[model samples]
Target: MTAAKKIAASESKARAAEFPAKAGEPAVEVEERSTDGADGTRHVKEFVVLKATWPGRDEADSHKANGAAVANEAIQRGLHPRGEPRFDGAEDHPDGLSLTLTYSVDTVPSSVDHTPGDTTTPRDVLRSEG
Candidate 1:
């Protein structure tokens, strides 16, 4: 299979594994559209966003790697992932434009108490007290 195809497949799998099966929630969605330039040439583009609830550290890291791989493949194919813009050398026209992928991992703040003075900062505290 081609590099693009492999990236797509991997991304799909990652999305599937990241989300739990439940009601009122979707794992991934792909949005695509087409537009026309002044010269009557039609330009097609697509963007993808994957959302999951409370993914673990390992899972989030895996998704990040997969997203980067997909973006790299798109760059190689002369296309951008989405929301990315480029400029061309032509005075009236841009040279190249493509989509770029950005991925982020959401996490909740730790509940464990870590306030200062709650725990001994120095190892000698116990020895001094004893």
Candidate 2:
């Protein structure tokens, strides 16, 4: 079987059942998607998100590795696990420092918009001639 076919088959297996959510979070949802592969075949990709937290950088890295392991396990269990586990970065929240990780069964492109916000203003410069 081609790489695309293998990925599709894996996604199908993962999506065959539901994965229970973590203790405090909502149930995990599996999203079915198809994207054009390099060889022109549309491959189905499954994705889900898992969360982890840490108080410091060392802990965060450890948690991220753990999260990746969990994500891979999800794939083995047919939970539509996507990607090789990604650390979505850490943020400081009222509760504590937290990280949002994404796992996908296949790679996907990402886009970012950089247009300045309406409320943003240019700062004036004080000119000093040489």
Candidate 3:
């Protein structure tokens, strides 16, 4: 069976719970940023980006599958998939397709910065920054 069919809901939830928000971890958020234009005008755009390190193989695989599901759902919603598959560095398994999915959230740079003295801090950052 395919990876999607093989993984059950409980198994996925268990895997996800392993990576809970620690006392000090980046908070993932979705927001829009102003894009500067050549003519000096700006436009707001929304994006999804995330940077997380999985602790083990199972967690990594779980994360990858989760990302693929999101992408596939987006495709179903009419968002065109961009670019060719960059599976060159992906691991191969004897079973079905074995791949990892990495996703990024495109937020305003100011939204992610955690440096001291910054005025705008995300809720997660503020909770842990002190």
Candidate 4:
């Protein structure tokens, strides 16, 4: 499990974290804070990237629609790579038709500056009689 902070606005930010996976549990799960103590809101979103291949042009082409569908949906959901999704590789599977597909996910939160306009009093650094 990993945690990160993403800055959304000058006065607000989002803290996104993932839960550790246990035996037989989902691999990725995101935990987000919508509202912070400073009266700011944060939204945590997740998207999916699909890469696949098959034997011959016909078989490989068959999955184009499905591939596009996922990327499109991810875009509508406010994920990264908005319009152009990345492809793992561009190669023909004319070789015995062996192929592979991989999946990954990530997110981030914010750091500091939660209350930019707030003020604080300074304390003395030295109070010594050693």
Cα lDDT for residue 42, candidate 4: 17
- Ten residues in sequence with the least summed lDDT for candidate 4: 121-130
Put down candidate 2 lDDT per residue, 78-109, tens digits, no spaces.
34332333333443444443433332233221
Which runs in model 1 stand beyond 4 Å of their true positions?
Answer: 1-57, 83-130
Model 4 earns a TM-score of 0.25
Model 4 per-residue lDDT tens digits across residues 6-86: 223311321222322221111121122221111111122222222342433564443343344333333333322212222
Ranked by lDDT, the better of candidates 2 and 3 is 2
TM-score of model number 3 = 0.23
Residue 86, model 2, lDDT? 36
Clash totals, every prediction:
7, 6, 5, 5
Name the top TM-score candidate.
2
By TM-score, the candidates rank as 2, 4, 3, 1
2 against 3, candidate with superior TM-score: 2
TM-scores of the models, in the given order?
0.22, 0.27, 0.23, 0.25
Ordered list by lDDT, greatest first: 2, 1, 3, 4
State model 2's lDDT: 0.32
lDDT string, candidate 3, 56-77, tens digits: 4565444444444433432332
Tell me the lDDT of model 3 at 118: 30
Worst 10 residues of 2 by lDDT: 121-130
- Runs of candidate 2 exceeding 4 Å displacement: 1-64, 96-130
